[model samples]
Target: MAERKHDRKFVRTFFTTPTAVEGEEDSAKMLRGAVGLRGMKAPDVWVPDNEDATAPSMRDEGAENIVEVVAENGADFPGEIHPRVVWHRDSPATRYQGFKHMLQISDPERGAIEHIDGFVIPEVGDIDDWKKADEFITIVENEHGLEEGSIAMSVIIESGQAELAMGQLREEMGKPTNNLERLFLLVDGEVDYTKDMRAITPTGALPPWPELRHNTSRGASAAGLIAVDGPYDDIRDVEGYHERMTDNQAKGMLGIWSLTPGQVVEANQSPLPPENGSWLLDVGGRKVELESEDGVEIYDGNRLSLEETGDGYVLRVGGDGRELDEDELREELLDMTEYVPSMDDIVDSMEEFEAAKEAGRGAIAITQSATLRIDGVEIDVNKDRMWDEATYQAAMTPITLFQDVYRNRPDQHEELAEMYSEDVVERAMDVGA
Candidate 1:
């Protein structure tokens, strides 16, 4: 993977606010409001959108709004600002228009270039098409006297050739010059991709293209860029949005596009680790949690069964049963239970392991115990999780995310303090320091 160029720690939410509203008397009212501190609360990357979100008639005014609003509030905004410029591989006219907008917004006189992180080019086609957009930005940088490769280029993967070019990104890293290293993110546009593929769906709706999301995640990882899922059009379906985020999180795509402020807050917090820890049982291929009655853990799931034999208790897993003594049964049951650590639990474990490593221990074992009752038979189950250097590094991911959020979104500090407490937040901020 190529090294990233910018200083953004992580991008959990990429939010795009429309630059102009058709009926609104002040066309740039939406853009002006979105650039304020309250409007830019949770998103790590905030975009003053000048593309599809705005109509063609208002785009010229929209560009001026981006420059004006960003100049006024960009200094106080916590997130990185990247305007979405209009571009199409098929039309040189549209591409030139986008280039002109980039020049207008990026001119040093505007005072918005310092706050702007990059530009998101949409409707990108093949590798050569991608290079043309990059070249335009290079010229804009030279024309504006900005440093070479200062303005990053992020492309949306909305076409088959663009998706295929992702695999070729590493090879084309520094062919002509190191400008490609200015690449920041690989965003997905599933609506256009679906249209491009001519896919027919039963409901006449956009298909949930899981393979496209997977490919985007893999491609971004291979090229050392952030992968962001496209926006969910149904803004009111909070539960559905969470489900999609959970699925995307499993694929290592932590970033998601947010169209509304409510969705921005949801997407920002969805990728972080759970606030509390819980235990889950792996039954066949599904994860089921044990039920608790009074003070005893009860296992009454259909996938698992317990039988009492004359010799001993027999544990049935799916369709297989094995006779085991009380101690063996407890061991078997504990092995089936997986402990998902909460953010606080992870911090505690990492701190303990860090101290151990400082004291010359190569590896350490931590014991976690739970009590459960099976068919009137009660047993104490204990399991040990071994932690090494690699385990500690892996455990730091959530902590690192917390630190990034706490640093970038001071507006969310009180919420973070309430969720994880001030002490844990302080420790998180000091983890890598």
Candidate 2:
């Protein structure tokens, strides 16, 4: 088989192509928009309509009925084309040949069709059902000569039963460790899951839905599956949309389903690391130097107040009733010092500045785990907090001193030989530190 990028760069932000196969023109128009969206890594070729639609009949429904609903709407199994085709070949409910032709005929002209990254199977209820779908994929490969194992395989953990049986289902599917390279867990089908659990909420809020979402993510992580969060129901609630996407990202979900182009940005976004900067902090009437991450905040409090002066705003220090003009604040003349970086000791500020450009901040990394007592709560702010609180200075100190002391003293070096005791120098010079 030809090398596929899926093993390296699998889908991140999934764009479910609009169910376009109901009509060729409709399908093309919708898919064009879906694929064209910015930040869209890939989209599933959708099989639409009865995608988990519970039958309205007052009788038991079977996989046979599902095959009919899928066949009625099955124009292309881009989502799981092969398994779907195999499932309905002898059922007589769908014109399976026409579906295959649609994929073959329509594929070449679809502008971004070549970017099809994977297949998705929705409404996966039981082990036998998944196995049949798996067989369909094999059949497609053997008969149609589609590239074997080219695209990743994914399933929506939508149905309640599916959520419970996910592990067993994967085991039965025989997704080997190698084949697991390109795998996915799309957390969706909350609506039907609510129905299955007989769960209800008059407020239409996800009362118990968060548990389902977490379970999907938890299961996916346990099984080493890439967890893509399902789509948000309402597109217009932009703030809520962002919050929901952020929530999923925090849960370690890889991506979220995008119904609109706008949601893509939020789904792909990572939270901005906390901004830290040097500032003059007055402690006990002395100039005490402090860094931003030391729980010292200059914003919001009795520290200072702003007032509108005729043309501009004036910052007045609170309680002391002193006011400073812009020029004085910018100058280092008065007890005010520029925010000196914690790394300023490693090299001259210029050298430290250049080192930042040379080494990516995430590189030259250290993993430190520590616990801090915050407001009576002992919080373990281990590596993650350190990662956030890290300033370029603290990270640069060890490198210059350790490499056989290869770093020549900067031209503007300060004579700080007296600052270190012999052991301190030894440790700093890799004797122990």
* Alpha carbon lDDT of each predicted model: 0.85, 0.42
Q: Candidate 1 on 1-433: residue-level lDDT in tens?
A: 4567876656788899888778889888877767764523547888888999999998888899899888888888878889999999899999999999999999889898998999999999988899999999999999989998899999999989899989899998777664788889899999999988999999999999999999999988888888999989999999999999999988989899998888988888887777766677777878776776776677776777888778779888779988998778877887778877777788788888888988999899988777777667677887789999898887777788777777777878887777778887777777655
In candidate 2, what are the lDDT values of residues 252-367, reduced to their tens digit? 55456655555544443322111123444443355443333445323333444444345433544545444444444323123433342222233333243445455655433333
TM-score, predicted candidate 1 vs. hidden true structure: 0.88
Decoy 2 TM-score against native:
0.50
Best by TM-score: 1
Query: Each candidate: RMSD to true structure?
Result: 3.1, 15.7
In model 2, which range of ten residues has the least summed lDDT? 404-413
TM-score of each prediction: 0.88, 0.50
